[model samples]
Target: MPQIILGPSQTKKIDGSVKKAGYAFLEKLAADDAVPGLHIEPINGSADPRVRTGRVNDFYRAVLFKVQGQGDEAHYVYLGILPHDDAIAFAKTARLKVNPVNGIAELVKASEPVAAQPAAEAAPEGGHGAGGAAPQPPVHETEPAAEAWSLLETRGVDKEALLDLGIDAALADRAMEATSDDSLIAAVEAAPQWQALALIDLAGGKPVEDVRADLGIDRVELSGDEETDEELLAALQHDAAKLQFAFIEDDEELRKAIEDDDFAAWRVFLHPEQRRYATGGYNGAFRLSGGAGTGKTVVLLHRARLLAKRDPGARILLTTFNKVLADSLRTDLRRLDSSVPIASRLGEPGIYIAGVDSAVHSVIQMAGSEVGAAITEVLGSRSPSIGGRTPASNWLDAAATVPDLPEELRSTTFFQAEYSMVVLPERITTRDEYLRVRRPGRGVALDRRKRQLVWQVVEAYRARASVEGSIDYGELAAVAAAYLEKAGCGVVDHVLVDEGQDLEPAKWQFLRALVPEGPDDLFIAEDSHQRIYGQRVVLGRYGIRIVGRARRLTLNYRTTAENLRYAMAVLAGGEYLDMEGEEEDSALYRSARSGPEPELVPTDSLGDGLSEVAGRVQRWLDDGVAPETIGLLVRDARRAQELVQGLEEHDVPVRVVDAHRDVRPGRPLVMTMHRAKGMEFSRVVLFDVSHDTVPAAYAVDKLTEGDRADALLRERSLLYVAASRARDELVVVWRGQPSELLP
Candidate 1:
């Protein structure tokens, strides 16, 4: 077997190429590298002594390292792939070495060889490298090792300690001095992108492990009697957990990635910030929140694997809000570990993976409730709606014939809060029970007479549901939790909830009922900014406490800087809060990649709207973007349907996605922005963003002054979620007058 470690650029290309080409290419490349008899091309003046080249195909060549081994063992490190001449040119000048401090190998570009200074040339007066007017004097060049010493000297930053820590004192100094913060606090805040331990630790007051993990600087201990190629290659390849670079250790792992065309798994690896959450220890309930692409889901997957590994016989329940997301999690889990059995039944032993509804249904069934059919199933599947139309954000659709419904109590938002926050939570059944229930978060106060009328409305809803064999989702969870509280053991040992922000209080209560209160019993990953369901659940209210154990991840792995900025800009100046109502922190939230700024094009005419978008899609296809990598999002189901029809009419194959989509990749995906949560793609086109369609009028029409502001914020959040789904490219098209959301 050939050992090939790819750099970021090469890894990116290979990952993309593999998705397009399949596993046969990788198998061939590995086989080619194993043959020593092949004539590997040598660069004329390589900076890296081991640089070599080999043919990948007729038109392609690979640059690699022919690392000579101690005795008979040897291996190759894949540097990159390029056309023949370019491969040779890259190898000729690429300098390679292990960072003496960080212990990670890096490829450095050699400076162009300088011609010897002309013997007759006078030395500059000011400094050797100075230019322009006559230089004044010779000056000692400052070594980068003193970087920290110069800049941080006045900020109580210790220079000697950094030098001892193997940080380049000069580079550290320069980076710090370059930062705008003169004070230690401001300095750390300004320089989150860099890895300066002592200052960072002091600023954040974080524990040592977290600081090291964030810095990606593990204690590296290198030794004398440097091993030969076999030993070095063996260590580098096998112990990639510590290496800056990594090679494929299990061919099966590589095959699985290729088979699924999941290029994400083929990347260099998870960043340390992500890895820390995956492997961190938590005392009680743990919650992690981050914007999409920050690897919250990745951490949950890895954490599930780690927990399963800790105790071989552990019964873990990996769950989320919906079946599609649950299925996605299950798929990623299997990729992480094939042997770990996936329990088909909710309460079956081993790892029981399920959507919240499935698990709740199982709980109800086991509790002998013999649950009634949901109202939607009887009334014909209805999306959550307000005024019979499903609003893009958090509008509950529940209608029942109540005799003389109080004129003041017809608001769908009012009823949703009454049911989720007041009635079911208090387990109120009768009119008197409902009257006594405290509606804490309900803003509109009702007098005793009005409250009596509200109770009448609540009673009528329950009676109708009971008579029609109709039970809504919240009822299922409420009944199961009510049952779990009085009888039977909890369902699983641990509960891991993804997209926690979408979960309501009832669902949280059910999740709480499913697990015993203990250390690491409940794990939650959520970002309230993505809460399209309009569920603002303060976890602490539901008995799941993660106060001090909460961690925030700010670095985004998906969505480029340009796209991220555009996405974030939509929600900018909007007050988004955590479930707990604290202002969500996005200050450090940043992207690792940069691309062309998002294009917000307004169609000149209504007639050209759909056709213009179709033309843009074709252009992307011509640019070599796979149809599966592209997505189309609209504000509502009406527009989603129209967009899909428009694409098909234009001869563009398009898939209309819902929560239960099968996700056929080669077709452009079109869906309502609401349905695009918890999903991502390489390119996203958001169109039909008209003012009337965006902040659905009826949904916010009944809102109070304070409530209206929150409604608009939620609408912006929906757009933010849709826009952020695009990893590299974002095209937003609007017709007529653009939505007020357009800046």
Candidate 2:
């Protein structure tokens, strides 16, 4: 059978008609290579005769590399879709060959030189190799002297070492011309997988041997002249080569790829760092942390699929902070491979995906009447009917019963935090229990007398809640966890969590109770910089120990370098702690792509800011960017509605996205910054980030001075989350004074 291998060059900007036609071509080619409609033929001026262009339509053509195998099977590497002329031109210059140093397949430009050169003579006299000039720096910076020092040379990594690590001869010369880290990154972006990654590591001050060992490429050896087309075809099977090319096995896989016009091809291109964590085995709880766009969620999804594949009868539960993200995980899991079994519920021989709360609720529902008994065990009282009750309303009413309670302690924020962080996690039911429990992270201090008053308020609150058949989300999780613990915890064999940073202590306890403490039990992916929920949880206290099982990803594959810089700037050097109370290493994060610097537009008023947003979106539309690919994020739902109304006045079509309604087709998205988590867009506008509106007075108004810093950090994280959503372009609009969070 013929093989259809999809390359990473699949254009994200392809139009609907051309994408439809491209899918048809791939489907037909995968079914039978001899299909006449494909129109696969050699380019007339191609140096490598294997390069071919297939007809997607009359005007659009798909470029491919046809390699004949030893038997009847042939391998077709699909480059991308382009216009007829551009396809032919690109096909004529493209060469699919094996890297002589590392034995990995690489697609190179045939027009450029590929011969190896000595370290000292690679870039002679401030010039790159044959047919190439010295690379230039950024526009604002002046060119350095003829003897400008190279970062690689300073670190003892010469051109020969680069070539030995799989870099092409021409690329090694370009790399030797790099004087700064940014310039080195720019030069290596066009290199093959192993070569580019090795260069990136070296630029980051990693030793050459460390880079080789980390990438697992030290054992690979080859010679440039001994390689043949068959050998190059076999090289495509190497792990490094697969980072740029994915071989689609059958019609189903091809169909899945083409169904989503704006397909997520990045999921297929896993870096060595991510591939290891996703496929490797681990003991007990494992946590993967990274900044935005670092592919943490991608790793979690792949890990879930691997666990399912390894033990065919294993019951795996894949969950996140909310249903929308969980739904996304399910969809991506299917797209990752449609053959993976997806279970509708827990305790099944397949992957069960849901929100953490939803999973708890499912367990509660499954337990039925026994829920009351479990609730009784934790609350130290008879279980009342479980119903929705606003925690603020209950806390306020309960405070009224404790006249001697401190005015500061009466605040809803204090009570809510106290209940979630201390009471729920500890299952404190009596005044004695509340008095003995340690409030480690709380900003406020309370003596025995004050604790007694607080206990009175808690008692009153519970009595009222019991009478009204009301229970908060925290209590709900606590009950579910108790029920699971009493029932022996057979709901699932493994639990994989995404966005684990947002979960509170009760939810973590619930998650921990779902699986036994053993190998491959819990896999968590989170980023502290994206924690907008204001929950600073310590996972160790909740039975999820990850002291030595934690790892971090540093490279971002989604946002552009400029956008990532702007987003990280929004954090304003604020310290962000992970689930284990350790500071996150956010400074090491870098992006894989580069684009225009983020735009910050100041306006005189809210109306003017709205108009600016509308104009910018209109320009994006004129430039052929899809409406659904654009996002406008604000601080709250009210601001989102205001922006939607303002956009409508300007005749700009937009939709307000919430947990219930997702991004609509052919409409620009208007959503709160919190709702925009776990989502990405081609372009994003942080709409109306005014001085008074952000930091959102309500979030910090009633907080004590000691707690203000944490509240402010959460606000900064909100802006960071919004800024990182932009994959290509980012625009920040502020009316009057800008938010202090904006750097």
Candidate 3:
């Protein structure tokens, strides 16, 4: 019988003589057939031979061999193992039992009889069965056989001695099992290969490859190039099924709601990407632009609510060109989230709500005395020739100086006479007396002459200031763009811009600067057709890309379909020809419910037209329409006043809503088309929709061909805006000739 090398430490200490002797013993045992029922065969040379040369410290000799018989095969057997002096010392230091000869002899003897057993009788036979069942054939008592093998074999080794060397009974049985049957060790060694196969199975499952692809991992091994469309579709369907709960289907209700211009439903059914645009990140900048009633403001409000909920510590700013619209948005936001603080730069808190001009003013305020001095110097530099004399007590005094003044300057006297003069229009006027009475210490007292001079200077300063800034509102965007260029975009996490399409090239530059390099940081909304101001803006030309994630809301809920149809017909050009009269029925836009059809009333003269429109306005008031809901929009302040007087003569509660005005407490808002850009009302009466009135004479004849077209486009956009302001009804009254936009 051969001795066994039990553990790695004892095997290392064996000397070469001991190892050779062990191997010789194993070979002789195989040749002699020492045990019955065992036909020993020496399959190979010693698997491991530990040889000690010279005086190498802590070294021993041992040999590993394979012993085979007719019944079973022993994968590993050891003989002549010896422990070194260091090995004995290491065991003693660790408080362990150390017996070199007995441990090795016991291991070898234990292995000998096990290798002598018949292959079939050593253990129970089991094969594949249906389901998880085990196939039964024959059974052998493995435990008793293992114990019998251990007891029968001896190489001057003791049982208690082997057990004391940390050789457990179970481990000894496993060793015997491995030595007896090569198949068990082969199965244990094949585990890693089985795990690899399991992974392949998982990867071959439906849609797993797609997920891997999305994650940028190779899925080629999982699915070879069979390219079966059925498999591909099944994979995608399986993936879609996983996200079924997250997706909001385009159902009949959603489709109908969108067609009916119900924003509430649209909000509910918004895609997750759309919701991300509305509320996701807040560290970057954003811009939302779109045609009228396309839910730009709706998205803005949603974004505000989302921001409020996400970052309660950070303040939110909401601004617009139209004061009324700004106020409306502020009101709506407040209604939606009461806990969120709301204020306007143009309104009270001087931070949240602001007009573009007002925001500029705040920046100027930060300029200290320099801005005030510049304003004073500019005001003083205005020519004394401009402005009005006190209301002449006599016609002789008026006639005396009136003739001496240039026609341009004389034509602007009414405007100059006002304390707060408007420089853009020659005829618009304001009262200095009223301003002085209302605001006592706002700034330097302005007589009619000084007011006129200051107005001129301020206009010039604004123009120069805009240019110097390289971007004012239009240039503010440019500055943003420049920053983006320099900073490389990672600085901002989110972006927001109100009136997105109104931004010109420079503004778009600013917008481009705001977009983060990553996909998660950018959100923008714009209405291409609603570029009412005709500003030289280009969103796409400046690298502001709109991918498939962009959404469009086409239905108009703010105005009746009849009006929307007419407006779309005029503005949409070829795209809307077939869509002219096609609109979902709604009570807000129906003529029967809201009012009469949007009228294209024309008269021979402006006075008659004004009177006729006034009569209709009075009739509307008489019919229970609130004065505030009825808006009278004209091309110019001169025409607006004429209509204002006409309505007043009919005892209508008329109030002119202008930026210059102190936002009158409550009156029928009488505004110019430009002033009414962002405002809305239940009923809007667009007064003087004549070709000449809309495309002011200067804009029509003075502009170059391209400029004229741009102006016309702008006028058309303004018309769209005005018509869309009517939530329920719309009326356009023209004198002499209809504008090209009128149906």
Candidate 4:
């Protein structure tokens, strides 16, 4: 059967009405032993021996070429798709040949008037279309192109390697012309992010391993089948099953590939650094942490798929922070697994995917525990008395009323910390452990008698909650953890946690108890800078260790460098720590591409800011960006609702997505920064960010004096998460004084 190659640009153009037709065309081509359609014709001047254009229909045409294969054999490669005239013109000058070094094809112009040989690497859109202009080569306007750099002489790169590894014609020529490797490196850096990633090694004399290590390129491809097409990018790539434009093996594969993107499979192919996360073998606990857009979720999805595929019977628990993100994970996992059952229940035989709360609840139900009423019903009711009859006061106030309480422990604040940070997390049901515990961060120490009185108050509070049939999420997690510990940790073979930095001590304990301690036990993807929840957990304390099994992805694939720079500045001066209390460095984190700087709209008043933001939202809609791909994020629910109301009043289509079920098309998504975690958008508007609103005074006032710095970091991290959500553009609007966080 004839091999069919699909161009990246061709795949990109296949959407909506043309989507079905495009797939059908591929199906037809793949099924036929010979290239289908009598419309196939050759252009007069094409240099690629196999350059041919065939009619997909009356309007669309497909361009393909040939490259040397096994034993001087040849195989046809799809170049790209274009309209009739454009296709003919593209066929007129387009020349494609395989690159020896990368083993991918490059688009070399056949008609360019140049003193030097043309660039062998594919230019934008798989070598500029007829109407497009190819990139110009470096000038020595008068001199004939300097002899191309010799791979054998410059860097000991084999000139005749079995798998193609030839340097670019233009890049080599430029490299040969340069007096130093530094100049070559500078020139290659000017290429697009993806292109630069592939060509950075062309600068001979620069330690290749050092460059790869610097850029975190850990993988060495044995076969080069990745697309050379410039227009198509593997999204959330790590799972090779969804490479839409890579290559067509058969009709069945083509169908699956097209459908993968039609539904927006939660991210596609993982980057080199991200691939280790999915397939790497570690001795014990492994943690993958990176800034937003670094493909952490992609790694999770692929890693889950790999584990399931490697051992179908192994129980895998893929979990995250909330139900909404869990739902999102489920959706993406389905796209990756396809055949395996991904259920939410913990005891099921297949892979279990859910939020921490859902997983703990399932564990509770399995163990026959009183999971109790919803947290809202419990927190909202008065039956669970803290101290007085009415439930107006917090748990701390309820503990304060025990008579003869030690002077050091009488305050509500102390009781709250003693219970949550120490007693409950430590499962200190007895008074002795509470008295002896280190209480590391807690400044005040308590004697044995004081601990006895505090334990009495805590017991009374728990008894009241148990009587009311109301248990908080923390309580449920604690119960589940204790049960799993006694039962011996065999519920799941592997536990993969996403957004793990936000998990509290109880939740971490629950996870530790759920998975047995083994080689592939627990995998966590967390970014401390993105921790909005006020849960400061040191993972080692919970028995999950990641000291040497940690990798941080720095090259961001989603947002532009400009937006990322501004986002990073928010967490710049703050000392961010990992889940294990180790200093996590983000100074190396950077974006792969550049775009216009973030737009900041400062208005004189609230109404003015709202109106300005609404107008900008309208512009994004009019610019062809999908409404569903745009999001408006704020610091709280009130601000989000207000913005949604204001935008709707201005005739902008907006939807409030406070839950997984709330996502819908034809409207811009609106939510608080807290709700927007684990989500990304093409365009984002972070409005209502004023001095008082960003680091909301309410949140600040709640933190203790020692935690004031942590509170500030949390607030800044919120802004970072919000800003990084914008894939293409970010617009910030505020009234009076704008957020000082903006760089």
Global lDDT of each candidate: 0.63, 0.81, 0.41, 0.64
TM-score of 4: 0.79
RMSD of each: 8.5, 3.1, 33.4, 7.9
Off by over 4 Å in 3: 1-290, 313-328, 342-493, 511-522, 572-596, 662-666
TM-score sort, best first: 2, 4, 1, 3
The list of candidate 1 runs beyond 4 A from truth reads: 1-45, 50-76, 80-85, 110-213, 216-244, 256-268, 335-340, 369-408, 648-653, 704-707
Order candidates by lDDT, high to low: 2, 4, 1, 3
After TM-score superposition, the amount by which residue 625's alpha carbon in candidate 1 deviates from its true location, in angstroms, is 1.9
lDDT per residue for candidate 1 within 459-502, as digits (tens), equals 55554454555467887787677667666477788778898888
**Leading candidate by lDDT:** 2
TM-score of each: 0.78, 0.92, 0.45, 0.79
**Model 2 steric clash pairs:** none
lDDT of 4: 0.64
lDDT per residue (tens digit) for residues 39-116 in model 3: 232222221122111112224423333322232422222222344444333322221111111111111221111111
Structural RMSD, model 3: 33.4
TM-score of 2: 0.92
Which predicted model would earn the best TM-score?
2
The regions of model 4 sitting more than 4 angstroms off are 1-7, 10-15, 33-43, 66-76, 92-98, 101-195, 198-253, 256-268, 369-393, 399-420, 441-457
Any idea how many clashes model 1 has? Answer: 20
Model 1 residue 88 CA deviation in Å: 4.0
- Separate clash counts for every candidate: 20, 0, 39, 17
